[model samples]
Target: MPRAVNARATVTLLAVCWCVVPPRLAGDFNPYGINSAYWNSPSVNAAYRAMGVGTARVLLDWALAEPADGGYDWSAWDTALVHCSSHGFAVSLAVCGVPAWAIRVPGRELSYAPEAFAEFVCAALNRARTLAPGIVQSFEWHEEPTHAWADGIPPLHGTEQRDPSQYFVAILTTTYRAVKQAFPEVTVVMDGIRGAFHHVDDLYQLGCGPYFDAINIHQYQPHAPGCDDPSGMHLFHFPTLLTYLRFMANRWGDDKPVWVTQYSWTTSGWGWGDIGEDRKAAYMEYVTDVSRRLGFVHRVFPELGVSSSTAGAGSAAVVYDDGNYVPGPASLSVVTTAYLRLKVCAQAYPVWTGIPEPVPLLPAASRACAVVNGGFESGAAGWSGAFSVDASTRFTGAFSARVEGDGGYVESARFAVEGGRLYEVKARVKVDAPAPSSAAVWMELFYSSAPGHLGYVMPENYYGVVDTRQYPGGWRRVCWPYFSAPGAYEAFLKFSLQGEGTFRLDDVTVRP
Candidate 1:
């Protein structure tokens, strides 16, 4: 039995849970995967590898698998599953598109009888189990139940008294029970909810909560400003998404994971607004960082493969099907880099038979050269400008330097340095709550000119970039190693915060 919880209590509980829970409890960070429909082309393996995702979604279409009662054909699906396994990618299968024979009205609609569909699902699960063994980790009930048809067949809500969504609850529970009975270890996820929260309420009203392991959602946010068709919708933004997460925790227990099966910002000329390519890349990376920090969304699969047949002129795919589906800037800058970072961070990220696990987060203390009260333990000694010891959050020791106000900079007292020598500067940082998309943290290395005038050299660009956006809400170690320019004698460190968010810095250090 489930206990009743109000929205406020749920959010409070979740907050407490997040504060106390070990940071790495949810160690399984599923890579950004592609939809099975998009990945079934001839160039799937190369595209999948190029995307650098460790998991592949293999959709098992009930319509194709069992054309008739007691009839089965597994050739194409078997081959696809084998290919994914051969490439060392885990598989998540979604069984959808009911066969006409199982439909009560005998139409090409999703309105199929519950008992009959459940039988078909059990048989398919049995076959997949035999074919792939333990490689298939998850089974999704359907593609998108609310928006099942493309040509306006309308979703399956039979009547006011006899809700079609209630029937879906029946199918989900029945199929879930059978799948569990057959394979207790496999994970069962709800059909990716495509419509609204009311439909979810409908399922909950029918007492259909115990059937699945996790909830799957396909949420697409619009492109940022600079796009011809910028999305004005706020539902896809981070704050709204957090509200939805709290709602789910209230409705379906916070322990169950939420998997975002499809997420991306479309390019211009698509039915959605025309967002430019660079903004698309930025949004993709931003959304990825937000989801990871939230910690509940276990998997994030951005739409990578754009199909010429279905996709518009400005397809959102990082790799297109045409010209042998070449990888683009979004693939390298966003998807590939995101995957490598996730692999390095996730505690349970699997290493293949021969591949070695990533090295652990290196300890920064031993390598750091002493700076006056660098850890902020001595209450901001030898520091200047709008900085104070923050006891609430610290990377090491009892306190850290907290910087408030937008565009405010903090500087360390001048430290001796040698010209033309390589040195490393690092800081452990995290954005204070209410972190806006525009909020950023940065650092600069200061030096003296020939005339003894103080000048600063930003390692790479005009403003040295310390990617606070990429940091996962919690404390993260960021380091920059650079060569001191010739004639640079003395040096100092400068840190600043920009936008409407607070930032905490600890263990600020420089070393040879």
Candidate 2:
């Protein structure tokens, strides 16, 4: 009877455990691959592996693949394939770089000759299969096909330019069919059109949908004014681009798969000329997290390090110079905690319901002064007095503050209206909290905004960016600018804490 009771207790515990754990989806697909060119070298392979990349998309130039019309050269590729296979990494060949001889007209180019291009792709695939039988097989006709075809100067053909869509369709259909027939196990993916979803429709019209097993998209958004869409809505953001792709897949009645073949966020500095380490670290964290959330994102190849010497030319993943490969801090960070978190999340949830629910607001505190802890504790020494404000408050005037602490502190306070015009902000901050022996405290004024919602529209425009600074301690009045638009917004106060000591703030107010 005692043994029976114990067994019953064990069963009850198992049941409770099952109820607490969420159910996981079966057959999750991970698209965390890298774009590695042959020029990247072996160090790149090591870097990619370190970053937890299990697959690489290699460029197979048509010009180089077949230097002479009917002659083929697979020596370079053979070496690369062997190396990648030996390392247990899969390779997705991007067939691009049209050969000059293949163009029908002299001094003219041919975008697609269905039969010839198909033959070339099939031959290459056949050769690859024979050379590297154990390697995972994946293929994309070109990288950003729409951008390449549309932007080429002197155009591919004169009269035939009437509708490049037809040419693209023919090329894709023939190539896909030929490759698929030769290697049924291989996954054929249609490369993304660079600009927008509409370009994808062009490919769809060409009846290219049925031939490929997956669709590939590339996203390269730079953080700068006017570098991206004015809306500030990035494709990497959750459920934005992926949702649209799902709609497209449903429309086609073919849900093969989707792969973000290439995607990256650039720091303000570095490849584009300035390398801001902080920005780089932040961007890496953001992209890797987003990739993990968007399960379909198969591979991400940051254009690595750009030519730092050129300043704004481009950066490659690992800058190769002086016979040593130097990886940027951002790259290293992605390989560490950030990328691992993403992988774990992807494995846990293949398809996300949506963005994780917003964190609940902390419990209210005394007046406008809320006790800041958690991630905020590390920056406590710069804490300033906090204030509560209403719709009528215009926080642009001078503010007085006093704090009890051993260290010196500076008080700079201001308010900036955010979200709706009617919404006001009030902040009191103490900057630069002194060292271990001394404590610093003061008040600073600023606004609070969601990370990715700064430049959106009405209902979504309810966010603001907050900038903070630390200063020496003392009771002094500081004048700061504050204004607002004519809409609804939330009120927030920011405080920075610097040292090991404690400080107190009182008498906070916001006036219309």
Best by TM-score: 1
lDDT of 2 by residue, 339-376 (tens): 34444544565334422222111111122223232112
* RMSD to true structure for each model, in Å: 17.9, 21.4
lDDT, candidate 1, 87-152, per-residue tens: 677878778777877777533355577777778777766766787777778888877666433333
How many collisions between residues are there in candidate 1?
3
Per-prediction tally of clashes? 3, 55
Residue-pair clashes, model 2: 55
User: What would the TM-score be for candidate 2 when compared with the true structure?
Assistant: 0.54
In candidate 1, how many Å is residue 502 off? 54
